[model samples]
Target: MGCSRPGAVAIVSVFLAGALAMISLVLPYWSKMEIVTAAGEKIEVALGLWGACTSVHPPALDTLTAPVIANGSEVIAIEPESALSDSFTCGSFYDDERVRISCTSFRELANGQCKRREFRGPASLCDVATTASFLGDSTAVVPDATVSDWLSVVDNACHGIGHTAVALAVLSAISASLCGLLLFVGITCGAIESRLGRVGGYCAFATATLQLALAVLWTAEAHPIRYTEHAFATSFYLNAVSILLHAAAFVAAQRHQSLEKEALAAMDLDGGIHADGAATEDKEKAMGSSKATELVAV
Candidate 1:
């Protein structure tokens, strides 16, 4: 009877929202890598939410480890007139599907890739660290294959978010859980019925608002306009929908509470009017009996 509010529906909605939010937390939200070439060929690599497949040996779940490759080539000579630069290519190919690679080596950037000796050829890939930064913001190198149609068609996997985003996500998750608790107690707690309804409404509303705000903040920090290729992930969208549901639940609960109060007041008013009418009837009956007796005496 939370102010005669509808508690059952509110509880169900809250439960569903909480469950969805928790599920989103576990799912990989945004780990897809979009690649494009200057000639217009595009490819996408999925580095799972929790881990990535850097090389074929085994999928590394904790950290990104470079592949292992033996250094066998000698250094290329560079003259002031040659087109030589600091950049070097390990190997390039026609298509990524044409070749098989293994998580066989880790690269030493200063030591001529996987080798300590001088080496040269087409580049295996753009540096992972560099590419990681590129994913967040633009202005980073886009690795290319040597061939015109199918140049450096290199792709791999990576993971992890910035400290700020992680912090926000954790805070949001906590707030969401608390909101669910409030809803549950508000509906079932007998001692604080009327108060719990309003309290739960406010708590859920506030938490959802915070979630939306933090989502925006996370997006702003993680995928700013600086990057030409950034899109909101499944996690962001799911949270958005959950927030909407929370808002709806809050409104429903508040309205039910207001209506309940009005009904209770109306019932009290009606009862008082009925009591006064009964008393008036009793007094009229007494007066009529006395008048009849006087007439008989006269």
Candidate 2:
């Protein structure tokens, strides 16, 4: 059966609201992963490589030393511009086998028996090898596989949780919309029969119940909720809007019932006559005038 004008409007409003809700939920997450890298830079390589490595390995100190001989000299010198020592203090290296290495170093050199030194140091030639040895020990390299596995676990959990929430939201919206439609149809049809009123009441009650259930489920899913200022404000706005829509629906439904009751009472006063019946002549005129007055006031 066709719905009344208000019922049609309600259905359209619900659909539009659902569309907007989906957009609100999905757009932010979509924007978050947009690539902003400079030309020719591998964005994935730049962002993912370090994070993947650091997931399993402890972060290393910023500076280190490596034993390097200058010319034919046995004396080891710290490369002034090594990854470990450069003032720029960025960029990475690949070993002979092309394995990526993130490291740093210090300036100055030492000789003789290498003595161990701290990351920052007083230096003598003998301290060079010792500093190199210490730096070598500071390499906090983690196995690539371990890092990958850790990332996979995190990705899987986030993916599953996010999809589940979206799915639930969609399902809830559909259920709520269908229930609302049923309630609208029932109320409009209720004037014709008592059975229709019973149906309408049942549908309206079910819609409210299901909406409450979905709200409860959403709260449970978002448990231990920590609300940022923005989230709190947005939630408050949504709640207010929902309350307004519900109030409007209730008011409309009540007015519709009142109109139907008055129309029925007028028929009774007209001796239960149809418009074609002679008895309804004066009563029909009075009823029409009363309805016109009610419409104008409304």
Candidate 3:
């Protein structure tokens, strides 16, 4: 049997979902904030699983939306330059082990150097705590916030959470790849009831479910202080779209399987009726031949 329309569409959806997953994995724009400075300058900060990126935007841009105004009354003012300090700040605050962590946004080379800061690396929450301790004054201040105190303040939210999230994301990608492989084989063999097809559908659903969890965890974990505006960035949105695609693929695969099973059942029924008719005709012919022989003998 040739590949059904639903099967073809499911395969396409799987391919697209895998592509989106890969792209989202590498790009570092999971969460974003626009910080309005005291000088009317805007600094955009993007946080990702691997790293963080910051860019200075001029206040003259009228198209800027989602501005987190730092008016000391509404949105507490934070020093734009001090917020995501350059790699130099990491050196001043963090020791040698923590200082070397490099997290550049989208892997871009800023001034031919990577953005090396406490908040840029995969262990950004831990690093951010250290930086916050050094900064002293914060909009969200914990009384007597030492480095360890800050850690406890957030209830050790950074402890292995980022790494675990990264692991889950990778697992999601791997599952998606396996799903594509199984789906491709099913399409080629035209087997609707193939165990491979069922497994592929399971994989797709698993990927979607895991990604949804990751999205929720990331949103909950990415709340840094002193910013009023918050939004999920392009990479985050891409993963979300990928999740939907995977879900759609699962539905299509199920439909294709059902249609193929029904067709197979119909074919079996028709073949059984034809066989019964042929057997009855053969039996009648044998009876007539015996009667003719007996009459000749008489």
Clashes of each: 13, 6, 0
Q: Taking the tens digit of each residue's C-alpha lDDT, what string does model 3 give over 1-298?
A: 5478888888999999999998887776787655555555554555666544445543443323433445444443223433333322222211223333232222233445555444333333446644343322232432332223333323324455666777888898889899999988876585667778778878899999989988887766674333246578899999999999999999988988898779989999999999999999999999999999999999
- Best model per TM-score: 3
Cα displacement (angstroms), candidate 2, residue 273, comes to: 9.1
Query: How do all models score by TM-score?
Result: 0.54, 0.33, 0.67
Clashes of 2: 6
Off by over 4 Å in 2: 1-171, 180-205, 220-230, 233-240, 272-298
**lDDT for every model?**
0.49, 0.35, 0.65
Model 1: how far residue 190 lies from native, Å: 3.1
List residue ranges in candidate 3 displaced over 4 A. 58-125, 128-157, 189-193, 223-227
lDDT of 1 at 145: 25
The candidates, ranked best first by TM-score, are 3, 1, 2
Clash pairs (backbone) in predicted model 3: none
Better of 1 and 3 by lDDT: 3
- Candidate 2, residue 196: the lDDT equals 44
Ranking by lDDT: 3, 1, 2
